[model samples]
Target: MTRHGEDIGRWLATQRRDWDRLNEEQQARLGKLGVKKAARARKAPAKAATASRQGKGGEAFQKGLEALTQYLARESRMPGRAAVQEMPDGDIRRVGVWLANQKQRRDRLHPDQLAALAHLGADWAR
Candidate 1:
């Protein structure tokens, strides 16, 4: 006998467009086979808009991320929270707080933090 499992996989691919039109019994059968309906496609412009917003800080963010990554690599540890807290510049302190809160040592800086660090300049990197 043919394997119903393999047949269901093939059927799902071909029937994707007609998914909503399938009768309750057919839908239940697919459900039992662990087949899920595909998520609705997002409009391209929506993605582009978000990218533009992120792009506002992308370059600066990249610079800060590179600096932080290099610092962590060479130092094997980050500066104490107090060092950042005591920084004369508010922007630098914010960047320090952001770095302190990261769960992993290798995590990249946030876009906003990168922008702030960029404003703080090459000194922040060191």
Candidate 2:
């Protein structure tokens, strides 16, 4: 919804998000408009959350590497950007897309991750 060139939905979302920062008069005005403050979301501790995410990401990367290894063994070459392959374990992976994404984000990868891919003859991974 729009009102006088302002996006009402987006404005309401922003108002709710910044509810705590609103002065009493502002809050009253919004309250009259039936725009309530948004509920605060609970979050895990940063260290634990980061560690958990890292663990999951590492596991996923290992799975992708395994899929890539099997693909290399069969095709004797890297998969193209649009190629998809079935792993020995029967998982269908878009290995080519995965590789492309990895190559694009190589700068963000850990040294060990880059080394692993480089070892697999992925020159771009180096």
Candidate 3:
């Protein structure tokens, strides 16, 4: 006779196709036979979580900008240079260059970054 495992595997292949077409109540019936309903797919987080995450991201970006500002002020004696050299992290240096290229100090940051700065109650303009 055929092995039980092989029989179950064969049965599952056929059942899986029908599983997709089955209604919730029909799918529940299959659970009694040791066939679980397929786990529901994962979904994106709710709007509140997204907003909270963005808020946190903005705070982090602002902190990085502030630190870069302080480092440039102390080491380079210039806040806005077209190119910054010899910084440890390349990303930080790139941000410094971008900041330096800004025509106005207030225009240095992205809108999201500005929003984040405001959210943290920081007045960088002073």
Which model scores highest in lDDT?
2
Compared with the true structure, the alpha-carbon lDDT of candidate 1 equals: 0.50
Stretches > 4 Å off in candidate 1 = 1-50, 53-55, 79-95, 98-126
RMSD of 1: 14.5
* Cα-based lDDT for every prediction: 0.50, 0.83, 0.52
TM-score versus the correct structure, for each prediction: 0.27, 0.56, 0.27
Q: What TM-score number comes out for model 2?
A: 0.56
Q: Candidate 3 residues 4-99, lDDT tens each?
A: 546766667547645877788767778777786455433234323434565765465555566555565566544445444344544445445544
All candidates: CA RMSD (Å):
14.5, 11.1, 17.3
List pairs with backbone clashes in candidate 1.
none
Lowest summed lDDT over 10 consecutive residues: which window, candidate 1? 102-111
Q: How do all the candidates rank in terms of TM-score, highest first?
A: 2, 1, 3
Clash counts for the predictions, in order: 0, 0, 1
Which of candidates 1 and 3 is the stronger one according to lDDT? 3
